[model samples]
Target: MKRAEQVTFGGGGLDRAAHLRGDRGALATAWADPAAAVLLVWQGKPLSTRSGRGSSPDQLVMIRPDHPLAASHRENCIFLGLAPTGAPQFACDISSWQPDALDQAMLASFADASEQQHPDLPTGQVFTELRRMMAFLTPLEAELAATANAVLSWHKSHQFCACCGQPSQVAQAGWQRNCAACNTSHFPRTDPVVIMLITHGDQVLLGRSPGWPVGMYSLLAGFVEPGETLEAAVRREVLEEAGVKVGAVTYLSSQPWPFPMSLMFGCAGIALGRELTIDHSEIEDALWISRADMMTVFAGDHPGIRPTRKGSIAHFLLQNWLADTLD
Candidate 1:
């Protein structure tokens, strides 16, 4: 796990200026700085330059703070942090702006392939699904995009105070919400999920959800329940989903999955036995695949199995396991 942080959405050395979160004076100066830039998010998607056909990678589009679109949505801005060059970085949600002729069906789909273009924004820049572009973005851009999406999603869902049943207001530069009625402060939440790589001998366990694509399969995963440790979660999830007993669980790496704010904890576990009694309610199918067959799956030659999606912790763990680099 030495290279654990190399996972997608891992730490990219972004200076999240937490000390300045409550300093209104410092925030004002940073906002007014000429080098300040704002990243735009629309309905959970981040604005990005489309990837080119050649060697160029898709990039997060950071526009000037004074831009008309950003200025109009200034109240919705969240102070992300400072860039390496000391420029202030912020994220603004322009989800209120509706694109012309937008396809509502596609937008509501599980895999939203549509890219939205604002009439006022620069040409070639569109709000694209983060899952579609995550692997193509730089490490720093991936981190920033994940942070912005998670925090904004939190704001959208937690508009009311749980303590006093009153509306809450944004505070601490979008990192905190304060309720005046009860004087309670709430922070963004990241649910922890344990995705296990369960192995016995040379074979690994994988399962596919009911509606997943025919050949798509991945490591078994589940949310960590209250009062449960990561190791316990892994064992419990594998047992519940596939009826496989796991032992000697060890942490591997983690990825920030911002499809609504989740931190996926990738772990390796030894299967006590190979027998599987798949709980049909939890998964459509479960099987044990040997290393050789997994290699075939990764190479796209296996007719029955498909590789896990790139940028996911499961993909990273499996790739490393194949290369014997999961140290």
Candidate 2:
């Protein structure tokens, strides 16, 4: 838990400048500040100024946004301003148009050629003209990238009014949608997921889903359905997948996984049974592993069990669990 924030997309304490959003004079002042910079996001990757194939070394990203309109431009990208901390600045992903393409000249600092030229960068029909360059941006950059993807995805999926079957208009500076016909208001949504570590004594549970890379194994996770509590969701998912009963579920930590927006609730729970009647429909295979074997997986020495993906909560939790430091 000490390095919880070190996890990929953990967080950077940006000011978010929320106080200025509603006020014209104040918002204009912050927007005009030279130190107040915008974090640039293209596709889902942060636009890093640093030179690296991956991993932005610092979280400070600065791009000043110029809306040039009296009122907010609906569906325009959001530029969260951050006041400088001792080190880099902080940022919050506030506004953006519905899921847009990753193309052409974006409005941030110049990105390297590797990002502008990558094959994955061509999906954007709108800003696809931005050059491709490869570099590792800091957390601020990652946050902005997540912002673009989440907002755009929301907009793409939510064009119609939920109440009146009429098309809606962007409002609230890209954070809200309004039905012109029915006067209904809509907001961006984030889904919830529970990623659990089921342990008996020395061993823990692991499973693999269909079509995943060979030997890749991690904690069992699933969404929290409406009307279900986090604890209930965990028990349900565990039973449904590996046929193991759970007891004494407790909250541990949370991470923002913005692959289309999800909150991963890391948890530790006790497995009541060792027998794994895997529902082949839910998991390819499920079983218990001793701590000794877990060490092998972490070391990449396991013949069949693969380690958790880097930057994932599963990896974070498993690393701590093995070290006896989940406390």
Q: Highest TM-score: which candidate?
A: 1
Candidate 2 TM-score to native: 0.76
Candidate 2 CA-lDDT value? 0.65
For each candidate, the alpha-carbon lDDT, in order, equals 0.91, 0.65
- Please provide, for model 2 over 34-149, each residue's C-alpha lDDT reduced to its tens digit, 9 standing for 90 to 100: 55554444444443443333553323234334422212332254434353451222223322433445344443423323333323222321222111321133464555455555
As a whole number from 0 to 100, the lDDT of residue 116 in candidate 1 is 86
TM-score of each: 0.97, 0.76
- Judge candidate 1 at residue 326 and give its lDDT: 92
Clash statistics: count for each candidate: 1, 31
Q: How well does candidate 1 score on lDDT at residue 113?
A: 82
lDDT digits (tens) for residues 48-161 of candidate 1? 987433578778999998899888877768999987889899999998888888999988776688988898987889999887788887788899999999999999999999
After the best TM-score superposition of candidate 2, give how far the Cα of residue 82 lies from its true spot, in angstroms: 2.8
Clashing pairs in 1: 1-327
